[model samples]
Target: MSRWRTALVTGASSGIGREIARQAAARGVDVVAVARREDELRTLAREVRDTWGRTVEVLPADLLTAGGLAAVEARLADPDRPVDLLVNNAGFGSLGWFHELPIDREDRQIRLNVLAVTRLASAALAAMVPRGRGGVLNVSSVSGFQPMPTNAVYGASKAFVTSLSQALHEEVRGAGVHVTALCPGFTRTEFQAVAGSDVRSLPPWVWMTSAAVARAGLDAVTRNRAVCVPGAGYRAVATVVDLAPRDVVRRLTALATRASLPAPEAGR
Candidate 1:
C-alpha cells in the first residue's frame, strides 16, 4: 500500500464503515474509526488491534455537529500523523415523506452526508496533492444514478458525492491522488433500519454484503477508478440507466420509489 498505509473511515461503528475499516486493517493499513458511538468505536479499535495487529484510533464524534466536523478536519490536515486514505462513509436517510420528516433530521443528513464529505475531502486533498499520493473513496449509492422520489434527500446527497468525487478524481490525477465514489446498491447494513426501510421485504438478490462493497471500493481506489458500482446486478442497472432516456428514467424511478416505500402508520 506504500504511503497509503493509514486511513480514516467515518461511520466506522457498524455496517459498511465497520467492514471497510476491518478490510483496511487486514491489508496492513492502519485505521482511524470515527462515529458518534464511543463504545462502538473503542470496540472496533480493539478488534482491529487483536485481529489484524493494526493501529486503530477511535474518534467518537457526530460529524453533523460543527465541533465534531472541525475536529475531524483538523486531524485530516495534521502534519504529524497524516492520513493516507479517507473513506467518507457516514450518512443516514429517512424513508417518510419529505414534508413529514423533521426539518432537523433532514438538515443533519445533508450536513453529514454532503457537507462533511466536501470539507474532509478538501482537507485530505490539500495535504495529499502537495506531497503527491493518497486516496479518497466516497461511499455513494446506486440511488445517486437517478432521481428517487421517496428517498429524495438521501439520493440527492449521494449524487453530490458521486459528482464531487468524479470531478475531484480528474482534478487530482495529475498530482497522483486517487479519488473514487463507490455507488453500491442495497447492502446489508444498519442504514436500512435507520432509514425506516426493510431490505428483507425486497428480493434477496438485490442486497450485497458490506464487506463486498467496501472491498470493491478499496480496490477501485488502488486501481484509481473514478466510479465503481459493486455487484453485477447493480453494474448492469447502472449501465442501462446511463443509456436510458431521462424522462423514462425519471418515470421508472418514481414508480419504483413509490412501490418500495413503506406505508405510513394508521392515526399518524
Candidate 2:
C-alpha cells in the first residue's frame, strides 16, 4: 500500500500544472502526472521521484480526444489507484477576434478546456464521494470574469470551470471532499507564448510566478476554499469587476484583450 496521498494532475508536463505536481510531491504526496508530452511527463516523474522519494506515475493523454479521456477514466476506476487529489488544469489559448480565428482550433479548445474538465471532474468525484475524502482543484482564469476579445472561447471555457467548481464545492460541502477554483491571472508560463502575448503591450506588474500560483492553489484545497485567487493584484481586479457595472467591465476587458494579443500580420 502506498503510504503517501495520491494526486492526479492533468497538464503536468509544464506551467502551473507542472508546478502543482512538484509542490504536491514535496509535501509527501505521490502523484500521477498526465499530459500529452510523454517524454516531458517521464522526465517530471523521474524528477519528482528523485527529489521527494514519492511514487510518481506518468499517464500521457491528450485530454482533447475520447481515447485520452477513456484512459483517464480507466485509471480512476482502478481499485488500486485511489486519487486523494485531482487537478483539472489542461487548457490552451488562441488569440484573435472569434470570427477571424480558425473554427477547428476553437472546437479543439472547447473540447479540451470545457468538456475534458467536466468529464474528469465526474470521474474523480465518483470515486472520492465513496471514500468521503478528497480534493479537486479546477484551474480557471481571471479571463473568465469578462469577455476576452482575443481569447473569447478560452475565457468562456474558464468561466465554465469557475462555475463548476463553485457548484461542486457547495454540493460536496459536508462530504469531506473540497472543490476549489484556482483563478490565476498572468502567470509566468508558456501560456503567454502560445497566446502570442506581446510583452511590450502589458504591464509587468500583472504577472505571478508559477510556483507561487501552485502554492496558493494547493493551500486553498487544503483549507477547503471555494475560490482561490492567487495574486493580490488579480484579486483586486476581480473585486473591481464585481463591484463595477457589467458593461464597464466588459468593455475594459475587451480593450485589454485586443491590446495584449493582436491579430496576425497581414502578409508573411
Q: What local distance difference test score does each model get?
A: 0.90, 0.88
Query: Model 1 — TM-score against the truth?
Result: 0.96
The residue pairs found clashing in candidate 1 are none
**Model 1 per-residue lDDT tens digits across residues 157-185:** 99999999999999987788999999999
Clashes of 1: 0
Give lDDT tens digits, candidate 2, residues 87-128: 999889887767778999999999988999999999989989
Top TM-score: which candidate number?
1
**Clashing pairs in model 2?**
none
Score candidate 1 by lDDT: 0.90
In angstroms, the error of model 1 at 264 is 7.7
Where does candidate 1 stray beyond 4 Å?
A: 1-3, 262-268
